[model samples]
Target chain A: MTISTTPVPEPVVADRPPEPVRRPARHARLREWWLGAALVLPALALAVAFKLVPLGRGVATSLESSSGFDGTSFAGADNYVRMFDDPVVRSSFRNALLVVATLPVWVVLPLVLAVLIHQQAPGWKFFRAVYFIPYTVAPIVVGIMFRQILAPDGPINALLRRVGLEPLAIEWLNGRYSALFSLVAVALWSFFGLGVMTYLAGLATIPGETLEAAYLDGAGFWRRLFHVVVPMLRPTVAYWSVLCASGVLIWLFPLIYALTQGGPGDATMLPEYLVFLTTFQFLDRGYGSAIGIALFVFVAVLSIFSVRHMFTEGTRKPR
Target chain B: MNRRTAARLGRYLLTFALVVVAVAAVYPLLFTVVSSLKTQAGFAEDPLGLPAGITLDNYLEAFRRMDMPRLLLNSLITTVGGLVLSVLAALLVAYAVTKLRFRGGKLVFLLIIVTLTIPSQAIIYPLYQTVLDLGMSGEYQGLILAYAAFGLPLGTYQLAGYFQQVPDELIEAARVDGAGHFTILFRLLAPIATPALAALAIFNFVWMWNDLLLPLVIMGGSDSKTLMVGVSLLSGQYDVSVPLVSAGLIVALLPVLVIYLVFQRQLVSGALAGSGK
Candidate 1:
């Protein structure tokens, strides 16, 4: 390797790659592997220490009974047995199933709104700005505000009464299933902006000529949404769904804690909240770990789907 | 009616409906702002209407009653520290993952993504235990590392996307020029990835600032709680006093509101950047 012979300075192609040779030396290839491992070591070390170990430890702790972090007895499957038998915990799992069922409403509304905004609907700028505000606001703050708004005689119900529909004004918080639905609605409201933003990004990648061509074929907005826009947007939707499913499992803790307390008969009790309650409130670390493991599995499963395509080189476009 | 006229009318109606939904989205926050200005009596008198009276007392109380300065400082340290840690680490490794194609490049990237699937709740206990074992619990370094660990996947993922744009010639040039990975990353790549770095910083900072659980549990109702967790605890004490709670909510929200106002476009673009694929 003669250092002096190779061109010392090329102004333009200095930043551009010279054509690759068919082969590289073995030592050079070995150096690349060491460099790569060294580069990734910091992030990898942190993940292993903070995330991976705890994940394994959490599973370990779930199998062992603990009284305030000091533990002795190996309670093999007792926590799981207790969790399944306990009616409140059972209902919490059921509530999770119900929440998961609402994934369509969560995904579709934002996709539709994003497409409308992409089409340049009236006041779309204002709509986009307004819609995104909630995403930035802390969930706890939103929870506190919604607690008031959804109080038995709160503004929503107040409006219902004023509109001559008194029968429709059910108890928003304290009723049997009202708080559950209220939780779902608030989650929906806060998160759809995320979907809208993502889909809008997806929409940008799409050539306008595609939509224009569809329009030329006598396709209206509805037809285009299904045939043209949707197929292009599926990847984004998949990513958002996985992100959101994990969110539903874990992110609802603050809102549930602040707004509903998983009350009115465990209707709104998500597994995360159940874990929180078990660990902190009741000092049942064993049971909480069990619930947390279940929630972790659920999230891990959903995340697998999204991460597959999300990081591929094909996703990148040259500037 | 003619077909064209009807289509335009329908479009207008859809726009009108969208506007209504937007109003619904922002109304609670707007209501909190308006309600914060009222006397407790005034708010109770007309919960749905504009305040009949105005005073800055609640805001004053909101500031004075809580340890806002300490909490704010704690928040700044944790969030900014987390942002730097996550970005620097992510940027270093992202360069490798994107450009190095070293042994197990795919495996490394996949491992990072797998971290995303681990529910923070599941790991919260052991993460908490790890911090305690180090005795760094409640300190900025502890919380910052925890936050960085939590945020690494998304940070690395997004930064790597931007990292892919670095031309091979530049990386090769640096290598040929005797620059190691750190030199290549910090002096060379870091400056070029400023836009992505800024986005990651703002995004991570806001997230750490807004998070309540970590501060609440790890900080453990001590002097070290972040501003968000402080406000959460503070509002509980205010209880039924809508004026005070609203005032507190407004206080907690102010910084993010300012950031949003100034960097709205960047934030939106940064958030949506990943979904483009």
Candidate 2:
């Protein structure tokens, strides 16, 4: 846990009185090790039993095919090959790519909002607290809430009609592109609060003098935000990006379930939900495991860069 | 177009935009609460306007249909059980790795942290199979254990950071009194670490209460569905009124809202703790 980035003063070995308790020290050290192992046992057991073992079994499951009454047999890479050729699988990955493409909005919108709040915009405290309210509501609740609001005869369209914009009042979660867009937008709405809080935490680390100096030199809000704030927040931005990039794939299942349910024609079918359908609904356990492994590998690779940045950022001594 | 006026104008514009965003953030929940109070006919008549008359019928109907009391009990049991188990395990592991400094402590910590990157969806089927094999499906322990396992990584990571800050001198002094690890940890370290434990508990509670997928897949067929799964099922029913569904959502969301209102600071800090550092 102590992945310290800075050097520490080493203990002076010669200064310590040696060996008076050597015989007892050996016994104590052994006891300490034993105690430590015992303490770690529960967490280790839970992790191995639920996470690690299932993960390994998931990989093995992906390689085997099963049929009713025929039992199971090793199918090698058959699922993976079929996955490549399956149009639904291809489209799910395609949708995932499109979601990833929208990562800039996921990253930048909150950064901008956080900057504005950090600058102490009027009513900033209230805005800061209120913005996080949506985040507290469960994704399923948020999805259900939006489902009502986005329905064809929902409040949003009602307002649109009232404003004489009837044509723009199409079903938000029904159209192909619009459904995907709505899904992403709702996810953002529910999550941007955390992103804002993250950037604000990063903003706290930047010295106020830097911002003051930039303003004194005639830099406006945008100038200071870009030149000073964004540069200082690179690690925080990276952390949030990694979270969102992986999160969009894995975390959208509940929302998708309650909102569009892969929509008006697989328009909102992300890989996570697809994995569920293929396994639980379609009973293609092997193929589902294959998709699941692919998703895991994709996420693991995306996480590597951030994991490094996170450790360094986490362990860095604050000035 | 002078400098002073331009600065004033920019500030006003920025404030105006922030106001709009803030409203967008809160309006949906407000809409839900408002709709939940309206009759179905009132909602159908004027979806956006204030209701003509308030009615608790939607709430009552939703309560009956979703079996709110049963869902509430199931959610409470799983969330509390999960929170206690995860926090206790994490505390022990954190204390051992940071304070005891045993062999392989670093590796153990690393393994737990690595699991953070593995999404639960990736191993859903195998995990489901494991639960079924153990004959734990449709039981509270199945979902409780799953929640505890997933909660361990972040909980341990955060607690380890807190435990690392406790000076070795504290432990040394406790040991000088001939106190065992359990005594020192529970009586001394636990009190000092209350804030971190509270934060972890709140985070896990909210997560377990709100989670739908695990409950949906694990206990979906049983009478033990969590509130979230029940609400989700309610939403899926085509004949269910929007107001009724909103009521169900409100019932499910009430606890989270209460926790957020009361422990907003701990919640925010806990979330930030999970944000890498």
Candidate 3:
């Protein structure tokens, strides 16, 4: 160690003259840094202005007690404590968990459909268009349309009634047992297009020769799918899982707010909907902020864990 | 079966299944269109059947209630503004990173990449607060800026990926000719990147046009309320006219439908291409 240190000092002295030449390069590097800064400053400014700065304020707001978005003072985590004791919050969180359970239908169905669609057959373009059309329509429109279809006297019930199945004709949107299912159905209708499209894109990146080789070995569709296509599609599956999981939490607001309004005794209440209620309808910004923060923390933790797991599990080492 | 016959059989079965799925997928929209022209009694009596009488009453009523013309203009303005700004900002950052080997280039790109994992739910509180603080809670600029920030990362990442496909030799030749980076990028690269840009523009436009939450949160009380928000309000207010509300929704969504039909290919491909998540 002493010998290494002595020689390192001699080299440091010998290499000192290039420091002057390296200075302009350093300046040039600084200029490059400025250029990179210049390029990225707009996005950074926007992110801070729209995301981080508001996060700070939101945290502050959550800690304070307020009445009708006014007269707020530091209330600490009382709001959080209240969330545990509040039956509505507990029920809503439970409902959200229930809604999340429906994710496999979105996550898994799309992969299967994508594989089916990726055959690139005679009408591949048409099939792709067909699958993607639903996404082009607004979610609100889809929700309204489903609301009509799922109404007490809507087509679905009318069909059941005509079949002399009165029990099957139960009110779709209002019943506590049925409301969550109705919301899930609406979600499937609204988002399945995007999911299918994403999967199709992922499937496109998979080299065909590998699947063909598996096929030549007399591997059946199931075998090829399980052994070859699935392993190849791991990245897409992981990406969509993270995206869809986050979406299961965030995007439910649209359908919930649109269709149920967390109604029929809060059977379909979700955290996002609850946040909206607390902040806007109830005018308790402080409590609203707490709920918002809690929701964020919950989602962030889940997303990080899932993403980390996906990267570790699905990541393929380069040969 | 041999390869040719096997491929042929696979095509047939897949196409058949797809046709069934397509009809099922399109049935609701087709049903809506048919129902929109029917009387309330007709709709209730036979929801799936063709209208007993093709009446324009629903549409006219919807137009009146929704202020369809103004709503259309507002949606267009916000969407177009969002599309242009998002594409431009994303292009600058993407081009700078993928085309130039500047210092901290990888770091900046990596930061944007990391943000892709950050769920929108985690950031909304802060974003909402920021919009409130900037006194832009009810303004078009606020919504546009928010969309730009939200859309930028994905847009930049996709465009940067596309930019990587632009041969470096072309850029090097331009550099040798003493063209400034901006000149080569704008004059040379932009033309080559038109297809990707078009796809990005269409995708961003559709997303902004359809977004309910941002406009709902930021522009609720003001005239800045978008078509989605308008339709949502209509949905919530029960005992209000249902036909008129449906009509309003139909009218609000017509432009998007038209645009989708026009750029159907680009829209589909763009969605598939940019759908990294």
Provide the TM-score of the second chain in candidate 2: 0.92
Error of 2 at A50 (Å): 0.8
Candidate 2 residue lDDT tens string, A2-66: 12233222222334443232234777688879889998999999998889988999999999996
Query: CA lDDT of A220 in candidate 3?
Result: 71
Which candidate order results from sorting by TM-score in descending order? 1, 2, 3
Candidate 3, CAPRI quality class derived from DockQ: acceptable
> Which of 1 and 3 is the better model by TM-score?
1
- Tell me the tens digit of each residue's lDDT in model 1 across A121-233: 88788788778788778888888888878877678989999999999898887877778888999988777887888788777777888856764455666787788877876
Q: Judged by lDDT against the true structure, how good is candidate 1?
A: 0.79
lDDT of 3 by residue, B1-277 (tens): 8998986787677678778778868877776777778777766676677878888898987777667777777677778887888788877777777776566665666555445444445445557777887888888888888888778767776677667766565565555445666666666777666667778887788789998888888787678778888888778664244455566667766777788779987765665544333
Give fnat for candidates 1, 2 and onward, in order.
0.54, 0.55, 0.40
**How far in Å is the alpha carbon of B60 misplaced in model 3?**
1.5
Model 1 segments more than 4 A misplaced: A1-32, A68-70, A215-220, A311-319, B173-183, B271-277
RMSD of 2: 5.0
When 2 and 3 are scored with TM-score, the better candidate is 2
Which structure among the candidates has the greatest lDDT? 2
For candidate 3 chain B, the 10 contiguous residues with the lowest summed lDDT are B114-123
What ranking emerges by lDDT with the best candidate at the front?
2, 1, 3
User: What clash count goes with each model?
Assistant: 0, 0, 2
